[model samples]
Target: MNKYTIRKMRKSEVEIALNWAAKEGWNPGLNDAQIFYDADPEGFFVGEYEGEIVAVGSAVCYDENYAFCGLYIVAPEHRGKGFGLALTKARLAYCEDRNIGIDGVLENVEVYQSVGYKPYYMNHRFTVLAKRNRAKNPFVREFKESDLQEVLSYDRQCFPAARQHFLRSWIYQENARVLLYFERDLLLGYAVRRKCVEGYKVGPLFADNEEIAKEIFLAIQDDIEGQKIILDVPGNNLPAMNLVKDFAMEEIFATMRMYQRDLPAISHEKIFAITTFELG
Candidate 1:
């Protein structure tokens, strides 16, 4: 008998899964565990085999209408025994009645599709050596606590779902750099840069045009000079593709964005870069 049991993961267990993710070359953020936990405490799940944890997954529900599944991994020694599918189904069941989404690796696309997920677009991860540039935008300024409401409002326009809880932690986390673009009292765009295992990542980069995106991106590099910077851009956004190419960034990774239901209406024109694959 296959004595494998699936259950919600404890807070500490999330860290273990993150370690597993790093070992798998995912390069997760340093404080991602706590932030991910806060997003949905009951979202993370693990499979125990003979009382030894062997598989993990997450079904983080952002709200009643939307959820995201990620971090699905089975122990190397436990692969080829249906553990991955078991964990995946557990996550799917958790997000019952909500539109579930995932940033799936290329190899898992068919597996995800077999279970109702349909590919919508691709997210290409790019990296470049951070160089100090004098690019300056007068409207760009450090994000302040007072800007939370406006930031949320602006972000809602760019993303399909509202993730205020995740955004709050992401913006306020230690060693994170967040910048906002405002013109004549109107918020135009924003970008967040955070330290990662390999270097730093800039994401959730929303802008009205390539110039605004470039200015904010370069400003972030200026703050953390000499470190490699990574950004994951939507494959369909031609201007975003051009933006990275202009900076001489190299494509390092890619994932297909899939959803279990009809794709939600999001302003891809404003989304120069996605927030994070694991959570969105």
Candidate 2:
């Protein structure tokens, strides 16, 4: 076989990587690659065979504690030719024994298991809403570019890796809205949403308290009025579990959000929303 090379991702390669993601039906956030690159500038990678990009992957490493391994893709023509395995190995090698996480396709579990990752959890989407009417929080203002950095920072701590590019675009897109909860000049938490055909959806909502998260959700509803807002909740998180079950929410679909490595234990009590089942 001709020499196939793997190298750290370049800014110019962002389009190709993002294009591949969209082709895979991932429904990735707008400008996902940019924000992802911002968080871990050089974390992604591409594999080339005789100058042709055949595969891509990213090990979005954060310090030595946590990382989210994602964006593993191989061009369709190269599927069974060993590119996918090589790309996966390349990305996973960067994390080694650190606490790494992956939200992967259910069918890929066996293959991932062979690589030393165990299934740690699952995820679900709640879409039904109760009959009562709740108004938006007064402090829940519209999303602004100034809020990008803070949102990214809050998101980074919640996940193993960061996607600064995706966050930047999604937070600022015309169809998306970001609402924040602050306490005494401190950013307590924030939530981001994007317009969807079915309705507006919220993910990556981070807060210090469930009430704060609820306020943010209400604010987002106002921001995108008269639309069905979707919420992705980690099935195992009790607060998220209970809150989703509360008034004005119904079950839609479920998927397993598994992790390869268990990082520092997150406070499930404070985590009422997951960014997304597919992206995070």
Instruction: Compute each candidate's TM-score over C-alphas.
Output: 0.97, 0.75
For candidate 2, report its TM-score: 0.75
Candidate 1's residue-wise lDDT over 1-280, tens digit each? 1799999999989999999999998888888899988899999999999999999989999899999999888899999898889889889988998999899999889999999999989999999999887757789899999999999999998887888889999999999999999999999899988888889988889998888898889888886677889999998889999999999999989999999998888788888999889987
Residue lDDT tens for model 2, 1-280: 3578888889788778878877875555564666666657667889998889999887877667667777788898888887777778888888777677777667778888887778867677777531223664566666666776777777766765566666665676666667788666677888877755356567777777777877777666653445567787876777677777664588766655666656346655556677655346
| Candidate 1 positional error at 9, Å | 0.4
User: Which candidate leads the pack in lDDT?
Assistant: 1
Q: Return the TM-score for candidate 1, rounded to 2 decimals.
A: 0.97
